[model samples]
Target: MAQAATITIGSKVRVLRVRDRIPADLVEALKADPTGTVTGFRTVDGQGIGLEVDLGAGKGAWFFDDEVTLA
Candidate 1:
């Protein structure tokens, strides 16, 4: 798991896994390339934290903290 203290905006990270259902296109995109840059953070379940990652070529997705690690 990535510690919130260690991750910040613009950090590089890699998708470890998806914990929730997402669009097929995004899933395929992640399969093709799981590494991306952290764009920002979002609230999940009104408590947990989610990371917004830019997968390049206009691709981006939000992932749970545990689903990603510093790359």
Candidate 2:
């Protein structure tokens, strides 16, 4: 089994699934969230990517990766 890869925003990534593949609505939902405070970007296992987001209303190291593929 493949290990879960860590992803972050602004980590240079690409979209893997299409509108029909996953659902156009789903994609839109993810886009709705704003990239606030999320400054840096990073990846894990090269499977997916993510971004280091601001810890707003939360704690500990956190990130947000809207894209599904690597950039």
Which candidate should be chosen as best, given TM-score against the real structure?
A: 1
Give each model's clash number: 0, 10
Off by over 4 Å in 2: 1-36, 56-60, 64-71
| Local distance difference test, each candidate | 0.91, 0.40
- Report the lDDT tens digits of candidate 2 across residue range 14-47: 3433322434544454455322344465664586
lDDT of 1 by residue, 1-71 (tens): 34866999999999999988989989899989999999999998998889999999889989999999999
Cα TM-score of candidate 1: 0.90
Q: What value does the lDDT take at residue 63 in candidate 2? A: 35
Error of 2 at 19 (Å): 23
| Pairs that clash in candidate 2 | 7-49, 7-50, 8-49, 8-50, 8-51, 9-50, 9-51, 12-71, 13-70, 13-71
Give TM per candidate. Answer: 0.90, 0.31
